[model samples]
Target: MAHLALYRAWRPQTFQDMVGQQHIVQTLQNAIRENRLSHAYLFSGPRGTGKTTAAKVLAKAVNCERGPSQEPCNECPSCVRITAGTVMDVVEIDAASNRGVEEIRDIRDKVKYAPTEVRRKVYIIDEVHMLTTEAFNALLKTLEEPPAHVMFILATTESHKLPATIISRCQRFEFRRVPLEEQTARLREIAEQEGMNAEDPALAYIARLSDGGMRDAVSLLDQIASFAGGNVTLEQAIDATGGLPSEQFARLATAVRDGDVSAVLQEIDDMMKAGKSADKCLEQLMHYFRDMLLAQLAPDASSSSGRVADPSDLRQLAAGFPREKLFGIIDTLNRYQTEMKYAAHPQTMFEIALIKLCTASGETPSVQEGSAAGASAGGAQAGVSSGEVSKLQARLADMERKLEAALKGGGVAGGSTSGASASGGGRSSGVSQAPSKAPRVRVKLDPFVAAHDSPQSKELTAKWPQVLQRVKEERVTVHAWLVDGEPAAYADGTVLVAFRNTIHRETTERPANKAMIEGVLTSVLGKPAEMVTTMQKDWQEALASGAGASREEAAAGEELRLVPEDGTEPAREPIIEEALRLFGEELVVIKDD
Candidate 1:
């Protein structure tokens, strides 16, 4: 006999032999036991999920010579004939090839005849979704009213393509993709039965790569088994699946987390050169980050990832990435994954996504702000002697108390001074010093209203560069974001800053960033102040009626102005050349209010 595929050789002979999908099996078996089988049944699911196998099993069970048994007695002549495809009573048709009105008409004509040998005539149509509209219309009436001795089973991976009329006539059972554990266990049983020596990890990896498809998993095992001479290892499985080794993904992720763009690009180049699909590479990266996320949230649940990463290493790696960054990474990858589907050069798209991830993580305030402190504090909370953490925490508590006291008017007041200071060295000159250990009175300054008129707006406009410089001196990332925004309105103590993009607006609106900018405003204007951030669109909408054709309009309508860093317009592309190439122009628009 010729060599048979493992999926065919180990096809489930009984309902009990089926893996996963117990719900469908139980219902079919109970129907056979009760002799209440439907006239037409639709078995729909992904490939390799046992739809055809299940249909065959149901046929054998109903036609078994002994009785309508819940489990097929494969030893019976009827069962053997059906299993061997030799029974005239049980017919299997491939709708994919023979999908025409003539084929379905033939089925309709044959359904009226009584079985020659078996108890019932079973017609199994595979890929029934491929049936043309005319073919479906021809089969509809016969399927709805089949003979008492006839049964129809339709199998399709895509049930949605089947017309509602055809679907309504049959009992639809949707088979689920087998779970990882189930696939792995079944593969292990098959390996032992075939006398193959395979590691559990190898089997698990094959199961994962097969993506919950049993036939695919078994086929992969057969291929790997032949290559490894019946002894399969994890390396052999990984090589056969063309999967990036877990170590490579871990290395790439580390580079991304560390903001090593060169390392990230190099890893991607290596992956591309290895014949890995760009889409699959991104999928693997997404899965890797997903595992990292799981490890961060619930470490025990991460064992399902099946990666060989050390638990301690995984935890440490996860510690470096906060939940927010991980979420952003996954979201960006997902969006780009969709874009890559239609892209001509998928590899370039993948590289662009990686670079964006690198920069985004590097510039994120949460990541950048905590990185130095995390390193200095030692090992993300462990390397510090417990006593040191306690002392630092105590100092923080004392500072909090002092801040609360000041805010409540029992300590030093908070405000910024300007170069336009009063004589006698500014406001501190004549104030009497408080007694030691006393909670002295502190005066809160009245809130300053903003001025949207010309002079105040121009003053703010002129001083914007100074404010940004002060911001940069205090927090470089905040300054980098703030440069995209211009002063839109300045009133008593509140300055409305308009940002062309939502990212810069949101970044500047963070409480810490807001406080920083407000401090800058106070120092530049010689009083306590606040800064209100808005997107340029919203600012424009507000000003379209009130400040008609104001400085904002004049600046935006003037000759092109760059954001000064990357030479692109404010809140636009990071690099000007890319924007020029994209738009085929030398000028880029900017909202320079």
Candidate 2:
């Protein structure tokens, strides 16, 4: 006897043997028993959901020598021939390969002929959605009104791709993905029948990997059984599926909750080194957090299953994270997962995503509990009442408000006498005291401030690194000149670059240097923006005046450090901006596949 694949050997032989699609089976059985067979039938669902199996059974039942029966008696010659694919009356076509108009026209011509040996002729076309428009047109009339001696069964995973006219003419039965319990039960039955030594957990794990596909589950089992010599363990199942053990997932959760970026990256690196897919690693982690969420909401109802070995570990992990934080973590992973499809380096994306999650702010209840306990004990020991705490908080808030008012009023937080006097209101507008050797520079501070506050300016600020890189690539001299300055204000496609000295400012304002920077801005931002140069002192003077600060104080305070002069680097893209773009003003984060 030739060796047969497990999925083929254990293919469902009858409707009674079909699992997790009782509704479709019952309806089909009733139709068969009542002799109410439709000329054309359409079966649609995900792969490995028994569409083809049902089609074969229907062919056998109608052609069974015993009679048109609810169940095919494989003992009869007609059923045996159909089962063995030797029956001329039954034709199976792979629509993916034979999807041209000529093939469908041939079927139309053949439907007029009588069955050679069976009671009726049957044609099964799989993946019918692959059929071309001309082929579908050719199939339409015959599908609508097939000959009395013929039956057509069309199966497709994507039913929405089928034409409305063809779908309307056929009786449609939607097959469903097998439920988890049912899939587990079926695998257990198959394991017993094959005499394979497997624990229930091992089979269940295989079922999970199958992802609701019975054929896939069986295939995975066959491969693992071959390797393990019929004695399958839970570890073997996990290894075969390329899934990390529950302990690793728990460790990963702990690392993330503790904000241990290095540990998280190490665990992910270890998994990738072990040959597990980066995508699956992220998927499993997402599910782990999802389980934590379930544990928090329904502690008693939560099942550890494939997520964790110890249910208490799940509960402990869940307790360490707030509901909102877990939601954010899941959402972040989901966005990266979507991007992974188009990304050239998916592993890099995965690592970056987890690193972000580690830094996200959300204190566990335990951390909050400690703080609260300390506050209460200290307050009680000092004989302070809640009323006093409220008063102190109000007083502190008032001080903060006044400080912000002072800062906005252009009072330097701390500065020398001369800077304070320069910033004081006595300084004339558009003119600052300068040494006899240096002359004051004139600039339109109002236009520069307005432009800097524009939304486009903020966008440019966020993507400034990319813009700088583009500039470096276009012309190094322009980048060199621009490096000394930082964008102070952007408005109406004009950027004000503030420099520490007049020399650099004058150098950047040259026609050639200015044009190069603007060209790069246009390439990066999709629009040309004028680059305006301003001396750092002049820019600060404008800022103080606009902030209602006395010219003396604005000039008196230490120089503003908003733009680093000595080649300071930009920080990682702001988390708040990224979060806003992802979730859009919602407190909750929803993960999408």
Candidate 3:
């Protein structure tokens, strides 16, 4: 006669009243109709799957006053009292609280008595696994052979913890978690009855978050109902539950697909300002990518049931990027999600993740539609495992250090191999342990033209080798390549030297080395030094060589023109190449061995 919660009020009272689990209900009903019931039953399942509810129904049906019927007459005093938990003959115990040997002993003592007013005495123990080993042993003896008038019902969320002996003596029924569709349908019915306004999308999101538990879905609905004032709105539901909006998630995927960094940053800013949880946003955005990735891979992933985001939006998102970039987005988002928990500033963390996602490059994996679950940080980067890459980089750095030390200690002859050129600190001898071969740097200018032409260039070139000697003096060695103006005529008082590269490049090409050259050059001509840089022919050779190239061979007919330097001939490499190649480009040292 007291008010009950919806879940409790709707608890099944008969086989006909059960919503799902028809198989269990029908089988139990048939057993009762035939009078072939088991003395003990073990019901195992996830919560809200109707385990204990079925047990109560069976008890009431067996004890009906009008008949030993498969249906309980709720109007009878016995049935009503049992349903309301007042019947003395029908006892329900929370095994979780009473899990010691004393409780089992008390139950054993009470099992000897006959039913006071019913055909059979029924005892239901919830969470039977909570019993201690001693308690389990104490009950094991009685359970093997109980009175014909007594029936025992044991229920548990995880049945594996039950002892083998206890499990062996009872009839076990393993209940599966209800599917999402079924749970959503059930929530809809309840919402309609309660007169609470709800959206299908909101209900579907709740059902998924419940993870196959109807009880969890109902609990979510209860929470949502309280927050929304009986009218569940999509925004309210997502905010309360920290879920992602379909539009926001869709935008995230689209930005990633397009590799649009600015757009990604804007989205991140908007979400952070909106007070959306950074970790939750990362999680849901990752989910959105997973869906897009699936659609991109599977030629025909047309349906949208299992997806958390909109499938229609995914088509445009997938079109924005090559089908192969999906995995990178997933990886970036997953990494951000994991790092968000420990981040001092979650906004910064998510923004960095967005940056990585927009810039990441690699193959896109082929994942089945609706199967992109559990894409954690370590799991997401299939092609480039960040852990492995970090480990490998660390190992390589260590190996390089060790190799340098070993070479410096001297080769097989005990002669140090670690130095020579002030510019290259390491010895020119190639390192034996490099994971990849060092690339060759080639400057192809015939020997004839390199010796003449720019006498000023020649004078500067002669000053260059002392860099190695200076290194012997433990000095800094800077190598600068003139990519701009040519050495021009060293006429009059200035002794002009010109370069074709920009000031920044000319500044860096070899400030230290250039200073050393300047010292030597001034020593040669005896005047204030004047070397200039210009970004002209930018030499085809220097441009082609990538980083830096030495100036060489300035013969008028040599024809190796490099940029807008002061020369009509091909730009040749400096005399430093032979020394670099012969001694080893990395380092050179004079040792005792």
Candidate 4:
């Protein structure tokens, strides 16, 4: 006889043999013993969690000749035939393969007939979620109102895919993944029974690799036992599975914490040379970091049964990393993992991710303990000194105060000095002098008011979104600054925009940014145009005061005039005007002696 795989050989025969699902087992057993069986049942859970096995066991229990008992008498003809799958009444269907409406219609037709060889006609449909919509519809009526001698058991790993109508008709049981301890113990029991020499660590590792699936753990153990000729060791298990040991992960993590780029690259190269795929290496490293985080957060509650390394070593390694740094590392790994999926050269992507981790700010372990103060100090040292940051903040506050004063004064302090004065006594004078103030550039609202409600202004408003999009396409930085302004008026080839944010208006008026916006507007509007910006509050005040030019004055080319608070126009040079336009009234601080 051919050797049966351990998973099949060790399949659960009854509810008593099932692990990690006490609630489900007890519920089913009580339903059977009390004669409260339902016509249709839905079993859903992860694979290898005994959904199908429990269905088979329930079938045998209901059909046993001596009694419909909690436990099936395997010796009875009904139980034995069902266990061997030789009974004509017990039918098993793989919905993945036979999921058409015709097949379901056949089942619907057969469910009406009485059992030929058993007490009840049992229909077990595995992967029931794979059934087509039509197939589900076909099975609905039969499942809802089957004959007294018929029972339907629907099993699927993904219960969400089943229709609500089908689910409502059945009694649902959820099977959970077998826990680590129970799964490991099962592997050890199988090893001893099969006369294989497997170490406890090897069993634990295989169990962990299975990710809570008993069949997967058993199959892995069988494969490793065969590969090692009945003597399975941790090294042999790792090699056979192409998995990295805990020590390698520890070394790589340590290198990253120490900011050792060369060491990190060398470790990746060694792993690549040893047949480890880049994506797999990244996945394992992510898991290792996750374990480390969990260990630190819940030290006593963390279990070491399936960890790659000892709990003490993990805690020790975790001490070197601050929580914030660990968060950044995990985020980087997650981002790179997503990108690596579609990358043509995964190894290159992996290397880049490791290098980023090594060089990221505050990645290196602090010289002192991993406290908040130490972390902050380390970050400051890595980027900017705290003293310099404070000085910069103070200067910014002073500038803001001066700017507010200037805006309230309704003028910008001018800095332009006459060349003759600069060449002579200006440089030799020892006496200090107060700064001179330049006149504010007051926009004459006449032109704007004359054209504010014109057809051109309305057209510009309609196409404003398109203009912003074109600006974004041409230069995103300009768009970011320009988006805050709205079209207020259009006149004499100049588009007037009102901005609520002073800084945005100032930035948008810079030569390069203004040129970019003008180019986009010209292209989008199909006409030559220039842009002029004003503060929204100022525009509102001007409109309320009715301070605007008449249509005749606007047509005569009166647009903007530089007037002082005393209402006198100053003789300003072109360079000075350019400076005022670029820096705005708030930022262009002018000093004179």
Model-by-model lDDT, in order? 0.73, 0.73, 0.63, 0.77
TM-score for each model: 0.62, 0.64, 0.56, 0.64
Candidates 1 and 2, the one with greater TM-score: 2
Provide the lowest-lDDT 10-residue window in model 4. 423-432
lDDT of 2: 0.73
**Candidate 1 positional error at 243, Å:** 0.4
Give the number of the best model, judged by lDDT.
4
lDDT of 1 by residue, 243-362 (tens): 888789889888988889999999989998889999998988887788788788887763445444323346778888889999999999998888687666789889999999988776
Q: What would the per-residue lDDT of candidate 2 be over residues 1-593, giving only the tens digit for each residue?
A: 01239889899988899999999999988998888989999999988889999999999999999978999998999999999999988999999999999999999988899998999999999999999999999999998788899999999999999999999999999998888688888888988999999988788777777767777888888988887889999998788667878889888888888889989899988988998888878888887787787778777762324343334458887898889888998899887777666555678888988888886642333344345433443344344567644433333333334335556877422222331222221111111122232223244456555444567768888777887787776555667777888878665445677898667777776655666686777688886555556788878877767744443443333333222234442232222223234324322121100
In the order shown, what is each candidate's alpha-carbon RMSD? 16.0, 14.3, 21.8, 13.3
TM-score of candidate 4 on Cα atoms, chains taken together: 0.64
Which tens-of-lDDT digit does each residue in 90-165 have in candidate 4? 9999999999999999988878788889889999999999999999999988887789999999999999999999
Cα error, candidate 2, residue 168 (Å): 1.1
